[model samples]
Target: MQKSDYFIKGILESDEKVVAKIYNLFFPKVLSFVYRNNGQREDAEDVFQKALLQISARIKLRKLEVINTSFEAYLFTACKNLWRRELNKKQKRVTNDEVKELVSEESDMAYALLDQERWELFRDKLEQLSDNCKEVLNLFLKKVSYDQIVKKLGYTSETVARQRVFKCKAKLIEMIKADKRFRNLK
Candidate 1:
């Protein structure tokens, strides 16, 4: 089903299954959108997720209603906005032409199909990471140091922390590579 249709149904009725299906359906589009826009599969996944995150935040805040557009357009717009913010976070300045060049392929279909495959592979791979790896990775992203990561994550030893980080990174790389998102990178 088209995710926008599914999502509007989910929102109107608050059906968990409908919501889950919407996530599954629209994520591929968002993933392809992100990857086509100077991001990796991971970035695509993240941008897609942030689209949902924004939805949830809006729901929680009860800030405003998305009244006019299909859920698909709203979702895609959210992803695009979030990615634009991410790119802006970079220190260097980027011109409008560069930004347009990055996402131009998303206006085409072939890139979209590849993105679908990549995100499905991505979701499956995340399920394979160890609990410890996931926890440590979260801490690392929080800007914690090796010592702080070990302490906060309850690792028995720093050696264990380092190994976990290394292994987690290796696993993430392998997962991304196998998914064809980072095949060109490695």
Candidate 2:
């Protein structure tokens, strides 16, 4: 078994020792990250717990054959994403209590996980594109001007650059839509 699979199995089986080891091994880094990112100790604790729960829930809900990345890396990313979502919600809070809308924390976390999965799918699909297409798409995402793309890519004209961007984008969309996971995410 892969080294990471041990942890996945342990978590799935609720092995206490393995769980403790995970907390000892990863909690400090998560704590430090949250502290640096405008969160308190409590926030870090919450994020860490939620990340583990999300990972476990995902594994239970699907086969989760392989992590692709190391388990540590995957857990850290989930924590970072959850923390960022928390920060965003804070920023969007309504000052007036009466005007505040009710939102379920469970639903929010579920949505965050789904969004992360969709992003991962998109990224994998993007990596599968041709080098030229990847470069063009990256530049387009960064909002670079068509003239700049033309100059950088040695295209003859802005029109040519625009056409290339549109085609590449369409291909990317097609690839993303073709993935089965895309439907579940929606």
Candidate 3:
């Protein structure tokens, strides 16, 4: 098996030694990311812990499978995403001056994290949709044109593909709105 597979197995099994190694290997990078994004050391620690918990939960649900990315990249992305959500929450209460300061110093990482959070939420809600809806929405998200979607999904016409995409998008919005976690995140 690959080294990343070992990391995945260790995380799934809660192997102390492997977990410790992962923390030692990846925590610095996560910590640095949080620190650079207006977070303190304690905040970085919290983010790291939360990322680990998310990974554990996904593993338990059989939702985390190592595909294109390494385990390290996955863990780091989780940390960035959690930190970005925290930053969004913090931004709501900050004054205009504070907001300006943050914006002035904003890194590409911050923007990427924001986009990542959005995509993650969309994917989470997409899973709640019907198989047909999932297919249509996924294609739409991938920037497939209406005519292409019609051909690919065997829809009657471009108009049908457009309608399916619109309906699926509406359903996804409804699912997101109904989620308690979505409210909490906002």
List all candidate RMSDs to the true structure: 12.4, 3.2, 8.7
Whole-model lDDT per candidate:
0.65, 0.89, 0.77
The residue-by-residue lDDT of candidate 3 on 100-157, one tens digit each, is 4343323533444445545567667888789999988878888988888988999999
The best candidate by lDDT is 2
* lDDT tens per residue, model 1, 1-186: 654555654655668887687778787888787777778888887777655655654454443344245777667766776676567754233443344423443332233333433443554466678887777777876778999887887888889888999899799768767775457323
Among these predictions, the greatest TM-score belongs to: 2
**Sliding window of 10 residues with minimal summed lDDT for model 2:** 94-103
Q: Which parts of model 3 have CA positions greater than 4 angstroms off?
A: 95-186
Q: Model 1 RMSD to the real structure?
A: 12.4
Q: Where is model 1 poorest over a 10-residue stretch in terms of lDDT?
A: 105-114
Q: Model 2 reaches what TM-score against the true structure?
A: 0.77
Error of 1 at 134 (Å): 1.6
Can you give the TM-score per candidate against the true fold?
0.42, 0.77, 0.52
Scanning candidate 3 in windows of ten residues, the lowest lDDT window is 100-109
